[model samples]
Target: MASISFWTTGNSGGSLTVRSTAGLRGLVEAAGFTEVEDAESPAEGRQVSDFAESGPRSMVDLVRGTGAPAVLVSFLDSDVGFVEAVTPGGGTWEALLNRAVADDYGIPLDRFPVEPAVKEALAWAAAAGLTPDEDLLLQALTGSAAFAEELSSLLLVALGLPDPS
Candidate 1:
């Protein structure tokens, strides 16, 4: 069985969307994906404030432990279409994420999606017609654990929508 993961860019375009997260999770489940937690990040010693840093850690760890093939819902920040090969060791961060995209998103050698995800996330962030950058993207991406902190931004897009990036 494959352990499928949907890695969102948090709030694409600067809007928080929980429904979007749920939508993707639902799709992954429909695709027969079992939710596997990731690994914990190396602590740097500070106030444990952000859930984004920790939430995915457990999931990452679980996937590594299971040795299950993964499908990453690609929220790629760039334009490389990386289809993954799940090797025996199969424990590298990039490998696991690539597998999640390739195995789950079904990346092809010839055709691949654009990087840096100019998807709805970006659109949502561009409310008031303001352009968002990578720094803003990271902040919006981590604003919440399961939803965008701001809801009005994603009035059109659902939180759990599939990766259109």
Candidate 2:
């Protein structure tokens, strides 16, 4: 429950591996986010007033810019959530907490992963060269109709993203 939307890059002992803030800015801007600003608390992280206009592309560019796995998680009132990730080798994955809620918001369900892709989590871990909790990762990928905050937290841990808090 950090924020409605946020980007997190892979970290080594809490240190980010993103090449530089400028590179990150370029990626974010390319993804259709304008006026990107660095988050004061999280080093090498950025926050937007709302979710990115091009979420999946933004995530892909994040991995490309950081040269490591990257994650983007967004929630609405902690009731519905969406999470997307991309590995360094171009592997991409995502999941949605509540497809119905997303559709209600006029957000296209097809744009997000509505079905289960638990195996992709393992693939992401392997590509990232890290061992994550299998059970937690699977559950995160499975997603639930409620408790979007929990889903977001699970994704953060499953992908080995640092906890800004």
lDDT of each: 0.27, 0.53
Q: Write the per-residue lDDT of candidate 2 for residues 67-128, one digit (tens) a residue.
A: 76755555556556666667777777666655565667675655555344467766776776
Question: Which residue pairs overlap in candidate 2's backbone?
Answer: none
Evaluate model 1: give its lDDT: 0.27
Best by lDDT: 2
Question: How many clashes show up per model?
Answer: 35, 0
Residues 38-152 of candidate 1 have per-residue lDDT tens digits of 2222222100011221123433332343333222322333211121212123322121122233334344412323233324334433431234454443333222222222311
Which regions of candidate 1 deviate over 4 angstroms?
1-9, 12-54, 76-88, 91-165
lDDT of 2: 0.53
